[model samples]
Target chain A: MNRRCSLITILATAAALFTGCEREEIRVYSVAKETAEAPAKAASDTPTPAANAPRPQLAYTLPAGWQDAGPTPMSLANFRITTDAGEASVNITPLASMAGKEALVVNMWREQVGQKPLAEGELAGALAPIEIGGEKGQLFEIAGSRDGQTVRIITAFLHRGGASWFYKLQGADAVLTAQKPVFVEFLKTVRIKEPGSAPAAEVVKVADPAPAATAEFKWKVPEGWQTLPAGQMQVAKFAVPARDGAKAEVFVSVFPSDTGGALANVNRWRRQLGLEAVDEAGLKALVTPLEGAPGAMLVDLKSDAKAMLGAIVPREGRWWFYKLMGDTAAVTAERAAFIRFVQTAP
Target chain B: MKLLWKFFTSLRLTVWTLGFAIALVFLGTLAQVHEGLWDGQTRWFRSYFVLRKAGDVWWVPPVFPGGYFIGAVLLLNLLAAHLKRFQLTWRKAGINLTHFGILLMLVGGLATDMYSRESVMNLREGGTRFFSEATREHELVFIRTLDDAREEVVAIPTALLRTGAEVRDAKLPFPVKVKSYWVNSTPDFRAPMGKNAAPLSDKGIAKDWDFSERPETKGMDDRNLPTAILDLGEHGVWVVPSWASDELLIESVKRTYTKSVGAETAAGMAAKMAAPQEVEAGGRKWRMTLRPTRHYNSFSLTLLKTTHEIYLGTSTSTNPQGIPKNFQSRVRINNPTKGETREVDIYMNNPLRYEGLTFFQATMGRDEIVDVGRSGLQVVRNPSWLVPYLSCLLVGIGLTVQFLYHLIGFITKRRATVAV
Candidate 1:
């Protein structure tokens, strides 16, 4: 009996230990929130420039035969010169605090043109000295082959006011060579001015020009709705007065393309109301055709406390999004009016 | 029963187990060339069987007894042998001590393997962290900010996350249903999305980007970027990827609104916008992220400074930037329970061991543009770290006692002969 009891105890203990070896369960815990801390003062001996220093403006004369290509994502000012040989482009870009990494910057341009990167020791030997805006700078002329054709690049960079400005002209060898002298003369005409200075004619301002709306659609404003100025990316805006301390707004926005499709747009509206997103099939089930508008679908999403009423209308190669978002009660009150308002012609 | 006892207590079992151990080590080392150290160790040493995939299929069969099997056998063999031959005598004391020491070591090894934890803490200068994250494993976390200083977090381990798995907890307002789980995925920002693009998550950053599945990374320096499409019944489907940078994504969205509203209002509305990896339900905001599994601690470490130094004027042909000679982190430890707030410096060789954990300086990097320095510390917790030392001491004492006893007996016998 004793031996049998001992065996049973051993097996039971073994089973208990094995059972305890299962994977950990889901855990819930409260932790102190992470608060951002200010970075410690830099220990370097040299004074580091502040990132948000006062802005400076650059004014330059546009060379003849060169047309302003407008601003690009990579450059603040862009100009193009077209000839029989090929088109050459000039770009002026400003970067903050490139003080000690000049060689790194030059190497990046070299790599762009299929040229080998130069070491910091070899940088000075490869670059020639030039003057830009009365300030000394380095000019790099690199010629490399791309797609069995010779490509030439002429770039000059200067450091001033804790910012590095690069003026680069690149194109087919023949075109770039022809425009090189003109680019150099244009660089000499560049001048940096402090902010709040009087503007010169043809001087490009340093600001992102908001895209002009291609087309406008008239909407029948409901009673008790207040008119407000449209914000960026919005064509028109209307505010609904606060009811029970809850405010709602209607925004009419247009995008160049289908902004990630109708499903994405409906989900974006749904997400605003703390509601779960639905798939394409689910979206179709929830979408209702606008009464007077053809090929337009309206979505109404409501959560416990919040709601959003939106419409996706496609017209004239653009997508129009109409959204009315606010407290659930307010949205519920305006659901019919919101749908009727979206049914207006584009 | 008698035959079983004989077999377990036999010396032949010991020899065979040791031979298998040597073979296991050899195979594991060779596997590391392709499988990496961590994975190889897990496959060969941490398991009981060496499993082989049955010809490119999911079926894996045990082909050989692995390290754990051999170790357990050897342990049982030693224990049984000691039990069978146990005798309390001065003459046999040394042998018994030596056997017990080896037994203790084997048990300690198993303990360490089962209980040890390795994690990492990354902190920028003046940043404080109360938890260390697992080096490789990931967890899905839903964090609700209760206030400016406190947050309620519910974390689900990735092991429990599988396709078609619905995870529910009392603390969760809704069930987290996983639609698809990718162990490794790469995001493409420029991929054109047509009407027929794969149906990804309906919300979050994944809607703006396309993700492609990739093979799991096995390199020592590489990590798998996991992505999961999760559905919360009525709340919405969200794509949570490990590679999403919440700060950068939120800042970009805030910048768009800041152009219209003032900077202050935009900053306040950052969480209000459809921020990536964020969801809202029950009038509460929850930020979801698939990140390295975190191990919270009772105390916190605040990074005060990071010092990186290199030998002056020393540059090699391969390294234009001089090789780092030293990396140090100055950290302040805060333990509210003990009312202890003290600063300590951890460097390459010197580590800070406190509260059953050891913090070693692992890596340091600096962002020259932002002038922010970050430090990574390897946190290791092993309760049996001193077991090897204690075992070695016992073995030394046992062998010394054995050798001295024989020497004394031999000398005394010789002296007796000389006197006679």
Candidate 2:
């Protein structure tokens, strides 16, 4: 190839890269956030109470033959009732807000039972007003077939304290129909108490799922520590080089909250080491606050042959656990370094 | 110049480049087991050099020539050899055409890799959407609500959202200080605050939930939920996680609106306004969210219906769930600018191509809790989609012509020998 031709080929290749590559750029645009006009108008017309109104304590009386199944992760209150027809379940869940998309929620239940989503125009007629906690609430009843069986779902929701509470009763069609009257009566019995007031039945507080946020944790690793693949529930793992024919492993793990608290975790580690579990007073004497790391507690537990040096630190609504476990000699050798590692971590 | 020309046209160089390509493919395929398909393809095939990450550190160094390097060398070698043996005669036509075809394919592949983008659009029955979301990319967007139901949005791509970086733009009122960014995360609802549990944020669901980073999942069905913390200075630090719904934050912000209402009528009006979370900055109400990167189009698609078929007699005593046979989504396309309106069905093996975009029915399911049929459409845009077909056609034609030329010459030689 001539020199000119070769130059052209090189230029063409470079040009291809520039032409094909999609540049990542900041975009500014004006877009219509909402597409449906009907739903937005309907939401505006819906009666919403004052947002700053004092939130009332909610308590409910259970219907006869209904067993309290206790609160679940998703539901604040759960109850079960069984009959010859089929078992029915009742649960109360709270959503911060639905943003006036109650029709969407109702349509979700409809689709669950193999029914189509309800149109916005038909949403008002589909919902029946009922009393809940002495306030007006809307009730939706949907019936459909699922897996060749007729199923029914009855959901009643009320807005309070800038949130929506949904009380849903779902079961087979025949069972739900039989319990419809009883369900209404149960709804009528729901009463609001003054702030911090206790009633005959206490509403169970359910834990909301907290998404784990990543925060940078910085610590200097001691020399001779070989990095190992972290196992499930662990953030980091390292193997200390063998010394005196004994080896120790370092594990760093974190949890959303204090995993069973410091005493329980310490006792569990003690049990693993075949040592007697200690009480709160014993735990207080055993664990010392890690130096330079505020709110971090360090504990040293040693058995006849096995030993564990652990630290528990709480930060940002999460608990960080660092442990050095293995042979007694190895754990003792690594204890100082392990304490330093935990102290330097954020 | 002569030495370089000889080197470029060397058969030895061509053989080595081809050998490296084979090795690149083999190694890249194997690397997918550890790095995943997307990451492996990017590192081994798209890049010019194969880079190896240092143990437990961010340092990565090039270890060997990657696919792009080998491809470029092979392209140059072919061009040199073709030019060196160039002839206008019909006998050389087949060889020249084959070389040109390969060159076209190489260029096309590079073009496709750079320009083509894949995204997904999820629509419920009777739902309409004008934008598709990228599967892997994410963006932090600040939106200001305007009159007439419109919103002015300023989006920052994930590449610019590094931890500790203060991102500033002309459109932004305040510099956004990124505290942390998690590539993949999980929510722990059982956040029991310890005695020294310092609050991460005063706004949003982060006040109640704790988030932690997890290893990125490679499964096709799984997606990484990224979380970020932004220090908005006087506006307060906010923890943002990629939640399916933004109602929690919207409600939290609205709760503050209730306190501002002085009159009874104003309180009633404020109560009815279920507005999004808005921060007052630069005399504008800004709402921020970390969400999937979106590619908006002028046209819109509304899902009319979704049909999920199951194999007959698949549900038995042993198998409670029936086997899925096929899924189809009926969608209506509406483009006001072009004045185009049409309805089409997208199903397995049958994709709908409209206006340079192809939509394939990827998955179909119903949300049990929400009672809505969902259809996931895989949207792909490739300008060079036809290049591979044309390249293969040219090669096939060239090979056939070359075979015919030799076959005719052999037949003629046999005839002349018989005549002698």
Q: How well does candidate 2 reproduce the true complex, by DockQ?
A: 0.14
> What TM-score does each model's chain B reach against the true chain B?
0.88, 0.87
Report the C-alpha lDDT of model 1 over A74-95, residue by residue, as the tens digit.
2467776766667777877665
Per-candidate TM vs. native? Answer: 0.57, 0.57
Candidate 2 chain B, poorest ten consecutive residues by summed lDDT = B188-197
Candidate 2 wrongly placed segments (more than 4 Å): A11-20, A35-54, A57-346, B55-62, B189-196, B244-276
- Note the Cα lDDT for every prediction shown: 0.74, 0.73
DockQ measured for candidate 1:
0.13
Report the C-alpha lDDT of model 1 over B274-323, residue by residue, as the tens digit.
23467778889888988889999999999998998999877777886688
Model 2: per-residue Cα lDDT over A11-61, one tens digit each: 575455444546677889988785642112222233454434444455775
